[model samples]
Target: MDYLEYDDYTPGNETENINITTEVTFRGSKSSLSHVLVAFNIIILVVGLGGNSLVIWICGWKMKRTVTTTWYTSLAISDFLFCAFLPLEVFYMITSHWPFGLFLCKLTSSALFLNMYSNVFLLVLISADRCVMIYFPVWSHNHRTVRKALGGIALVWFLSALLTLPSLIFRQTTAHGLVTQCFTSYAGHSTHKAVVVTRFVCGFLIPFLVIVFCSSTLCVKLRRLTIKSSKPYKVMAALILSFFFCWVPYHSFVLLESDVKNHSLDLLQTGLKVGATLAAANSFVSPILYVFIGNDFKQVLKRSLTSRMEEAMAEDLRTIGLSRSKSKSVEMI
Candidate 1:
């Protein structure tokens, strides 16, 4: 989010360049725009925390363990943890200061990136799982198990943690006049470029490729079959599309940041701020989208909160039982 540059000024005096840099950094503290961003983040914080928390409860505690449930549970856990830290971010944005200690700053930033990576990877796994189920139905029916899904989930977490290590290491808090900001401080231009490239490839590009491939293959396979239920395929498509839309801007800006000398620094900073906000918004939107699309919306709406949760749990258990029966039949055959 820190995109300001004092060195990139229009051919001007040193005094003018310094003034511009000061204006850009301090603008967030004084601008009404900061208030608007903080307000939006607050809304996301509330909704995302509630929605993801509910998903975690339903999938983790109530539902019988299954491959799908395990994935959903992991997704919910990531989103929930991200939302749990939104208050710190919101406070920082609103005050235009990092009152949180340096450790908390690094922890929150690392956690955010960790969640982002884990989410995209988990979605890829889910899409691949569905693709296998659709294209190799017999094989999937016999082989898909909660244990295997759990292993995949663990791997995703480990890789996510590894990927976020740089953020945790590089994030630093520094003060400018009365304002303090927390941002990644690379040792050199090469380090910054390397980090950006790595993030773009691992965090966005590769996962997106896998998602598109799986979704397209699944869609084609579903179309070939005479099944009347295409809603799941539609939901998968929407989820992938949403992830792409939300994250592409953020990654594009990050890449642009690496070569800020070639671009308008002011414009790039503005784009980065907007893109980062949209990307953060995705954490909340995802849970709401999944619940509305993946569940019986009308039924959920009619029941009390507790009752709805109970119903979801019961439904998940029934689904797991049916899946096990199908697996057994496939095995016998």
Candidate 2:
């Protein structure tokens, strides 16, 4: 997905005084960069589409339903859908043209944002669920059910879509000479600033904070339990670190874009492109991370897809089954 800055261009006699020395150099560098980015996107599309689709099938169809499966299934769906749209983006990037027109421009952009917001929030939910299960096992046993998880997933999807409305509303395709570009446009400077601020806060900062708090609290609780195996903690740390590593650069570039002066425009643009690529890479990285988290390295190397999924859902099955037995005993009392 391309993140574009829509700046108004005005032609006047003052244009004659503007320096054009770096124009040719920037153009050459940008062309090479674009090719590299397009190739990277192609790789991401192939790997992400295949990996996430496997996760969806395993979680949704092959495995028994549970809260963990439900959450993961949703995550897989989002990543798969985002990767599905990458072909169109790859084509646009390769040709430097937007042949798909306005509706698709809006649709793809909205879908990207939808995946981003939904994935982060779902992670927060997962972290919170883990924390609750560990700290308040009794309450978790009584209340954490597949039905409740499904309901929460539905709500997260709705909120993600709602947050993506601005992208759908403002994204447009404009043709300048031979090149057609897809970008987000706002009616005024204030509107643009508001959109950027909203994205930074709602899309990045708040969810990140929630993940950190939940993870830190969960870490302390897990330490108190004197658990011998550090595997689960390591997996949690990887997930948290991956999320920030993938997103922070993109958001930082976005914020920096607004403040950059004219002389730094080329550098800022290149940075933004790199940031966007890193962010998009998250779709593929996440599924791989989940697989690693589910299985030991040797198991991952040896297991078939079905067995891998079964292994992934093993803990969920045990947890749910244990909760049911506990609840039944409490009811009998």
Candidate 3:
């Protein structure tokens, strides 16, 4: 994505009538901090991959493989895929330039965000599910089958796919002899701004609001109950807090990037620089959090390694217990 600059726009000021295509510089820092950020980022990427993948494996094996696990599994997959791309970001940070071609630059940005949105979307769905179970009780029990949950997950994937389509269509690499940059060329004159605005609204702002509202509502509702299982809220709270913390500054930095002057950009740039580090760090923490909250992870990585391990073990013992008891009854008769 290309940053837009404004000749007449002032920093920290919102202008409703400003041109959307105005070219702004990304103006981040070039200090020892960049080195430190990248250094830690490598460690984060490694941990995030191991942690999230563990989530998928555990959910797949040790859990009963219910609707919730399916949904969480799908979300984990998205995060895992995104984690796969972190090395690129780490490299770009250290190298201070995108050596990858135009297609990759755009795909990398758009795809990772696709996963990001997918993560938030699934979280919203989970919160909504909890709210239904809390408020509607019987309805949720009758209607909350795995089939229905899977359908919703499918829709989320389809929508996320549609949202990320712009990057594939518009993202391209360009070189001005000495300098190389990754950017998108909008088809129409005004369409670029229109698209950017659309992306901000649909891809980010709308979902963010939905997640915030749904998760907060769920948090409030669950907090009222003194149950052991509702403890998932703690996980939800930490996840949401981490999620927003990582992305807020990135979004703010992007907004500032689109409009701010050099001076303003410089300040926000430092924030942006650190924000990326924070975001990458966020990825790693999620997996570790899963291990703490989801017993499935711990159990699956046990001696048995099947997604159906929990069900199989329960069924096996149930069958053996029933068979022996039946023989005893027959002998007594």
| lDDT of each candidate versus the true structure | 0.76, 0.73, 0.67
lDDT of 2 by residue, 1-333 (tens): 434332322234213222111111012134778778777888999999998887777667666678877887788899888898888777766665777888988888777778888988898888888889899999999999999998899999998999888888877777779877776666654555577678889888998899899988987888779765676556667866887898888888777754444435556668777888788888888678767776543253345555768987997899999999999999999
Q: What is the lDDT of residue 13 in candidate 3?
A: 51
The prediction achieving the highest TM-score against the true structure is 1
Q: Which segments of model 3 are wrong by more than 4 Å?
A: 1-30, 96-99, 176-180, 184-196, 223-226, 299-333
Per-candidate TM-score against the hidden true structure: 0.82, 0.80, 0.75
Q: Where is the poorest 10-residue window by lDDT in model 3? A: 20-29
| Candidate 2's TM-score | 0.80
Stronger candidate by lDDT (1 vs 3): 1
Regions of candidate 1 where Cα sits further than 4 Å from its true position: 1-27, 175-179, 296-333
Kindly list the per-residue Cα lDDT of model 1 for residues 182-238, writing each as its tens digit: 766676667777877998899989999988888778777777789866656666677
lDDT of 2 at 318: 96
Higher-lDDT candidate of 1 and 2: 1
lDDT of 3 by residue, 1-333 (tens): 234433345645534323333321232336777667766877877887887887787777657778778877887788777778777766655543566886678777675558766877787888778778877889988888988888999999888888888767776665656656554555653555566566667766887788777767766776687666644666767777777787776666665554444446457557666655666566677777766775655566664556458789999999999999999999999
Q: lDDT of candidate 3 vs native?
A: 0.67
Worst 10 residues of 1 by lDDT: 18-27
